[model samples]
Target: MLLPIIKCGYELCKSENSENLIARAYPQLGKIFQRFAILQFFNDYGEFVLHDVDPNLLTFFRSCLSR
Candidate 1:
């Protein structure tokens, strides 16, 4: 699921001259995953739990959201 989204984002970003890939893809990515219950899954499991599972993923999300 995420792999495909990441690939799509990469392709889209590569097609453009955008400096911030995350910012460009954030809104569309959020909409796609949010409907699939990904957002709910993250919400149900706290950030601490997510960090424990995958610190990099947590960090990535934090960085994207902060932008």
Candidate 2:
């Protein structure tokens, strides 16, 4: 799940930039993008188990990615 998103981000960054800003920001963007992807995945597939999901975990994920 994450591998593909990271790869996509890498490819997008590589294609869009001449500088290494993408590489430098990969960690942050990767975290953000993966979080978004996972949330969407759960929204689409894990709808049945959504009630058991931890809101704090999502917040923590957001915090980690923000840094």
For every model shown, what is its TM-score relative to the native structure? 0.35, 0.44
Candidate 1 lDDT by residue in tens digits, 1-67 = 5778679778888898687865867786775566445445656776656345355456557654555
lDDT on C-alpha atoms for all candidate structures = 0.64, 0.68
Cα lDDT tens digits, model 2, 1-67, are 6679668867777888746776577578766766676677676777666465578456747686555
Candidate 1 — which pairs collide? none
Show where candidate 2 strays beyond 4 Å. Answer: 1-20, 60-67
Q: Which stretches of candidate 1 lie over 4 Å from their true place?
A: 20-22, 38-67
